[model samples]
Target: MGSVNAISKPTPVNPRLSSLPGESFPVCIIGLGLIGGSLMRDLAAAGWPVFGWNRSAHTVKVANRSGFDVSGDLDATLRRAEAEKALVVLGVPMPALPRMLEAIAQHAPSVGFTDVTSVKAEVHELVEQHGLTDRFVGGHPMAGTANSGWDATMSGLFDGAVWVITYDNAKNRGQRGARLWLDTWRRTVQMAEAVGAAVVPTVARRHDSAVARISHLPHVLAEALAVTGDMGGPLSLTLAATSFRDGTRVAGTEPELVRAMCENNREALVKALDEALALLQKAREDIASPGQDLHRLATEGHAARMRFEARAGRKVKDAPRRPIIRVQPGAPGWTDQLSSAESMGAQIGIF
Candidate 1:
């Protein structure tokens, strides 16, 4: 209900904290769901200027009681953001984006904008639709659990997680106003790193495509797997163990959230789903025909899993250090350079 700065928290001296123009830019997060709430917790804990908003006054009260500055009033929250020059983060679901963006455009049009939305391209389109592109940076933090709401939130959720910061450079193809665009990108990256996340610079389309397979498709598969396990009946349910739990972990996410994630990224998800179906169809055919070995599927799957484990382990086990690659905004082909570096597993070290 109060301004973000109304509560004073000393900024912790952290090497992970990137040097911003103002040292620490205040973050106003709208929607106090799991991702937003967890972000608020981590940023506030790290001594950054942060506050949040949720439509539910009860959720706001809970966050407030837990010492987070939160407002249930959208207009007041945006007013504070405008007054303090805060960077506004949209943490609501895809279905709620339009209304949130409209309110933001009306109340705090000049503030820097970013989001933790699961899908990036659609959000980017919506931002562009509302003429909020100038100070906007598309972002999606690749973290979260099969949980929802304020109570499900926990600090450090993004610790060592891949927090994607997206920029479609083509949008700035001939524009001279790269400073604000670049600053927005840097601010989002700084905030992500401040919460112990590794920043991956990318474009909105690529982000959507990649997440379709890695993030969204998994939810679809998990739902199918869960149902298959349930169809196995009482004995099978009783005997289900690690594999079932691991495979269906994301199936426990709020159904509406899963729908939004998959439905919003429909095109990419369909492509991913088609590929998955092809693989399954081959397996089915192999099983139906006697004497046909499942060696190809089994071997390829094993190798793929192994490769993933190796890559993921390296990322997670690596020491928390600043990004090693730097990309300048206005430089020629800088966006392409960042994308190229990202392809090689390099993160943005300096803006």
Candidate 2:
């Protein structure tokens, strides 16, 4: 996504929103690991009613002791979500998604659905298989430390992060049905913004592809970098400094979590890995040749890094103001219109 060129006036909310749940609806988070636990803390601190569920009894106990509304009983937790008309966020890892979706289907069948999973396409598929797509909006927050579990969770983890929201599985649900999805979307955008995260609307497939290059591929590279560093033996370990440490930072993440994140987006990650390997192979060939140098790789890499910095260094307040693009849910091609605007870097205004 790039900067939007068109700036317009604020669009009015869809009239249908008046018939749906109010803004004060609670949040029910499933899986109290880092992402979910942090969400529970932040939402509660911001004064939204929030509760959560974790499979581990010890984690639930720890969270409860820390004054969070988390429990070990899945059924009881989902029952409360239904009673409270909450927006449900699944924060389980990719390997655990199917089982979690099954529980959601059997327990709280119709609540607003979303997830904090690293991958989106698979989640979109599973949500449809479980008959939850009508209310589903997939999400991934571009934030996390090389940490996991309740003990590793902390507040402000999502602050200033780009929270990608996907609508790839959505359909033309007519006017009344549109209201349901729209309400769910609004609530999600509200929650993300409340936590100081920018909501970046996109389709699931694109989100997965983009993250594979910028996120999953980095994890793979980091793992390889860390292994390479170790192969240099004791002298390299003692002499390692900022560059080596920074490059391999994510390699320090829990191995299973790293596997789930990278493997879940296997197709995209493999393509990204192939591209990266090509570059490394070229560099190796250059090293073998007598007069050749890393001129091409270094120049290209430097330009790419500069582009990223130019885009990242621009603060939201520093950018030219642009109107939030509005979409009439369930209208003909409404989702398409939203997707197009998102490609132009426009934020989908909450209805």
Candidate 3:
């Protein structure tokens, strides 16, 4: 924390990245919002030179006050990244990514590009449109709260959390920078692990669908729950219990952030919501049936929820942390062994 400029080529935190000699290459985070600012702080703490760019002057002031080397000039930052082949992490909103992707593609094509957005397939489209699929790996660090901005960020937030990294070697190996792709993967995992996240390799579409059910749907439901009850009622606040308070916790997240996520990936979210609705309907019917023996839905729901909670706490012992699912543009049946429909191919062995 003394001097950001005094950093060195970071040591590899994991054996898989042992051969990646220290280039002392810095990482440039394009946004200084909660995720981006936290990443910069953690990377700098790990002895990697870190630079950041943010649009808001107040945000820049806050970052500089926090001792981060944030620049208001994005063009200069991108040029610096070009010179060092520094990895770029885009932590901006989903809609802002395409323009930034195009810029990174044109100005910093040599460096590896990744993101912290929950949605993937949309960005995958932007990556392909800009011919950046090879140089960019889609990512989502499952570490966040109902907060935003630098002050809201916690440096150790990602600790013990799941960070999903997308992998693909579908590109022809003959491409000029094909080998660098592997280096990018190593550096990405290395940096992610440095921040205390347990890396999980997954496909983009698979990640989107799983997050839709596990993450996105929860936000929508929480917002609805928070708004459904009468605020005017005198007993409304007094009647709330731990369940009510905990269930609507995510409703406190910034409206824009919630809106962006729900709007961007609504297709997948709608499907998950539909399933949730059907299950609720079944439970409703079962509750209406006075027969104690016909409460099958309730029993199934309890067991299902318990099974999820069980796996959520268990870490894979022999599971390979490297690329678990490979995604190629037209690779036939790639999903056959890797679909979330089949437990998200979590059992697929890493080669």
Instruction: Name the top TM-score candidate.
Output: 1
Candidate 3 wrong stretches, greater than 4 Å: 1-24, 168-174, 231-237, 292-294, 313-351
Give the winner by lDDT: 1 or 2. Answer: 1
lDDT of each: 0.81, 0.78, 0.73
If ranked by TM-score, best first, what sequence of candidates would result? 1, 2, 3
TM-score, structure 3 vs. true = 0.81
Instruction: Give TM-scores for every candidate, taking all chains together and pairing residue i with residue i.
Output: 0.87, 0.84, 0.81
Per-candidate clashes, comma-separated: 1, 0, 0
Candidate 2: tens digits of C-alpha lDDT, residues 273-316 = 99999999999999999899999999999999997776573323
lDDT of 1 by residue, 1-351 (tens): 354664454453234435542367799999989999999998887778897689998998888888899999999999899998898999988878899989998999677889888888888888889887888888888888877899999978988788888877335433534666777777787888777677788888888888899888899999999999999999989999999999999898889878877888999999999999999999999999998979999999999999777667334326534335766655777777787866865567555
Comparing 1 with 3 on lDDT, the higher-scoring candidate is 1
Candidate 1 Cα errors over 4 Å, as ranges: 1-22, 169-176, 238-241, 314-317, 320-324
Would you give me the overall lDDT of model 1?
A: 0.81
Q: Between which residue pairs do clashes occur in model 1?
A: 323-349
lDDT of 3 at 133: 74
User: Model 2, which residues run further than 4 Å from truth?
Assistant: 1-22, 174-177, 313-337, 344-348
Please write out the lDDT profile of model 3 over residues 1-351, one tens digit for every residue.
644443543443332322333434578999887899888877776667889798888888888887889988887888888897788999898778878987786778688878999888888888888887777888888888777887787676766567787765434544555666766766676677666566666777777888899988999999878887546365876798898899898988888888888888988999999999998777777777787344677678789899787557433333343234433323455435445423543422222
